[model samples]
Target: MISATELPSTRPYLIRALYDWCSENGFTPYVAVKVDASVQVPREYVQGGEIVLNVSMDATSSLKLGNDFIEFKARFGGKPRDIMVPIQRVMAIYARENGQGMAFPVNDDEVSSTPLTAVQPEPVQSLPEDDPTPTSPSPSRPALKRIK
Candidate 1:
């Protein structure tokens, strides 16, 4: 018999499925990642430690959605860069056109601790005509501010 700890994470499988779904339906697949020392991406484009990536087949090259990590090469400002994000650090994966996708609860713990679930509401900036790879998503703040 296998224990819960022995099971692989459902996150990677779901991410691949969503990517396929978006591809089959002509929707752009975007992944929102919580940036840390482990995540490799452009710091200048990252807004408040979070970055939204356009993972569509048209945008990325040598894309590999693996079990432990998502590896790909994409262009930022027309300069190609290798992007890598640990599967557990992904905050959400959704269709950029319709905002229809799934979100995972990202934390320091392992992905197997909790089952995959629906996505979160993170607003993104409108895409530009020439550049649509790195979307500047405003960071989310759950706390309210005091105003006079």
Candidate 2:
């Protein structure tokens, strides 16, 4: 089992890679479970929604998680459960011969190519063309008072 701390400081890219693979290969594998349940998310991510996975390779029927632990089950060939795997324990993903599997390897030097940025975009300003003309505010007239 590889703790997140044991992995490189970079976010484990396995999740993103799996998402892309499923999309391209017509597999409906989804994150199914988020690492941070406390993180605020749009209603769509939780309401009537099961992460909308790309389930082409194997059909995941259920997911479970515990303290520092995560697990899931997948179905195949019309069977209720064809595979049982853990999230953190998964290293390499393999879907072959109508089945899905995971590998656990201990390597911490793999570089995640995603870039982190600290600079934010500046607000845009609309400037008037240099016509060198000044505009004045409109003036109102005073009401006439009756002299007694």
Candidate 3:
């Protein structure tokens, strides 16, 4: 049995919570992903080794946000395509309107196996503008808090 001390990663839970929050608040949810060999997405649309996708219900069909991966069918340039992204590859998920989102730190092991010398950093797309203005957190809006 798993002990309370050995908890699972909170990334997947946070993703689901944020996705639901965006949906309830009428905000378009978007996910930024780091592209690699394992990721299957439209290469032409990939910029700077990453791809930003709209995972809203209207934007995708048969969307499945699983703990290991997020799968969905979205149209690119009017052509339907299936997109698969590993949860570890998700850089951030945020509301497109207000830019309210959380960014995850990349683990060293998650880095590409290719040597740094041979790797070329692609121009990654920047996240939406985060409003620095402070706002009170309500029960309706999820916020990341650290417990000591």
Which candidate number has the best lDDT? 1
Model 1 lDDT per residue over 1-148, tens place: 9766667778899999999999999999999887888889999998877888999999999999998889999999999999998888888888888888887767644443244343446655677789869853445432221111
RMSD per prediction, one decimal? 12.9, 23.7, 12.5
Residue runs of model 2 more than 4 Å from their true location after superposition: 1-12, 27-58, 63-70, 76-84, 95-104, 107-148
Whole-model Cα lDDT per candidate?
A: 0.80, 0.35, 0.76
Which pairs clash inside model 2? Answer: 27-54, 27-55, 27-56, 28-54, 28-55, 28-56, 29-54, 29-55
Tell me the tens digit of each residue's lDDT in model 3 across 1-148: 8754455567778899999999999999998887888788999998877788999999999999987789999999999999998787778888988888886644435554322221223444545578555544433333322211
Q: Distance (Å) between predicted and true CA of 24, model 3? A: 0.5
Which residue pairs collide in model 3, if any? 48-122, 48-123
Candidate 3, residue 125: the lDDT equals: 50
- For residues 1-148, write the lDDT of model 2, one tens digit per residue: 9854454422235544654565477554433322123222233434332122223434444443332233445433344432322243223333332334333331223222222212223444544788555544223211211111
**How many clashing pairs does model 3 include?**
2
Give the better candidate number (1 or 2) by lDDT. Answer: 1
- Write the candidate numbers in order of decreasing TM-score: 1, 3, 2
